[model samples]
Target: MLVWERPEPPDRPVPAPLSRERIVQAAIRLADADGLDAVSLRKVAAELDVGPMRLYGYLATKEELLDLMVDAVHAEIRPTGDGWREVLLSLAETTRRAAHRHEWLADLLGGRPQLGPNTLTGGEAVLAAMGDVDLDVVVPAVSAVAAYVIGAVRREITERRAERESGMDQRQWQVTHGPYLLRLFATGRFPALAAVVHDGPHLDADQTFRTGLDFLLDGIGARISP
Candidate 1:
């Protein structure tokens, strides 16, 4: 009779129900709104009207959350079946654009490469694009091309962020810095750079990405065939 009351259920709090997909989507939204640094189990839980501990049901740790967020962004870039070269170029540019849009994406490493689905997907796409070429040459060649594209994109995104933060859009930078650049070039110390950057042209990232990809592939072909 003394034990029949069930101890009033111990007055425990009810844990908020959560799912992997839901948590991932919420984290994506959080990242989209406030960049990668804003996303955490506690932060997401506050947004989701739950406690931080609840996130463990879906994501084990903060690192896991970061991995999911990056992959989610990667999932947005769809590959159209053109040729291998075209597809790879498109993928490269697409990745660049996405990283540009979400500034934090360029820096998300997820500790290890394999844990991140998007990173793996992108790597696979590069391999697939080079599938037509000799594996030995094509693999290294595409790797170099991908590295260039990523480096360029990272630089571009960083510059863009700086411009946005400083209230100097591309137009303003060109208007203000164009003269100084020309003046410096007129000094002859940086003749080649000055000529390339004369009057400051905006880079067409898409065209640049494709052209570089082709150049690397051509080199690979030459090495393989010769």
Candidate 2:
């Protein structure tokens, strides 16, 4: 059973009370600092200054803890705006921002069905914001935006990590590889590809994300009955 579905243990009188919230928070901190691989029941117990066995009252396994952590982060995604498009835009942007704040989130996003309280609430808000659309339209519309957000956020985080590890920004990385790319493109055989490399807009990450999202929304708008 999911951790959220199981009722939390009643508070016991102890020098330092240990609850699921504390356990999840400690796990999140470990994940935020050193990525998901760093998070474990043992580490979280240590962070809380409790024995590893003490955590069993609140969590059954590491996967449960991960689920809680992901849902906890979802609390940061607050959707706003009046119409379906505007609301979905808000949801997508906020979800992206949340992933940026918690880079480990990219690893867990869309990996499983998240039915935690906060995730359910966010879904409810998004569906509610869709107003009176038919269920088929609303479900697909929300799923499309969500899929885009997950894919975009994962790609953005991957690039960001690569840049950090390589100690070079995107432009610097491109410049470093310029000679090889120049040689590859110099061949007259690849005209179309060379043209884009030489003349592309060179948008920053945020601009690129927003632009792609807008294009997607426009396409969806065209399909929606007015």
Candidate whose lDDT is highest: 2
Candidate 1 has an lDDT of 0.69
Which lDDT tens digits does candidate 2 get at residues 154-178?
Answer: 9999999998898999789888999
Error of 2 at 214 (Å): 0.5
lDDT of 2: 0.89
Against the true structure, what is each candidate's TM-score? 0.77, 0.96
Model 1, range 82-189, lDDT digits (tens) per residue? 556566666666877787677787776223554345656766766676556767776676666667766777777688778878999878988998898878878999
Best by the TM-score measure: 2
* lDDT per model vs. reference: 0.69, 0.89
The TM-score of candidate 1 is 0.77
Backbone clash numbers for all candidates listed: 0, 0
Flag clash pairs in model 2: none
Specify the poorest-scoring 10-residue window by lDDT in model 1.
1-10
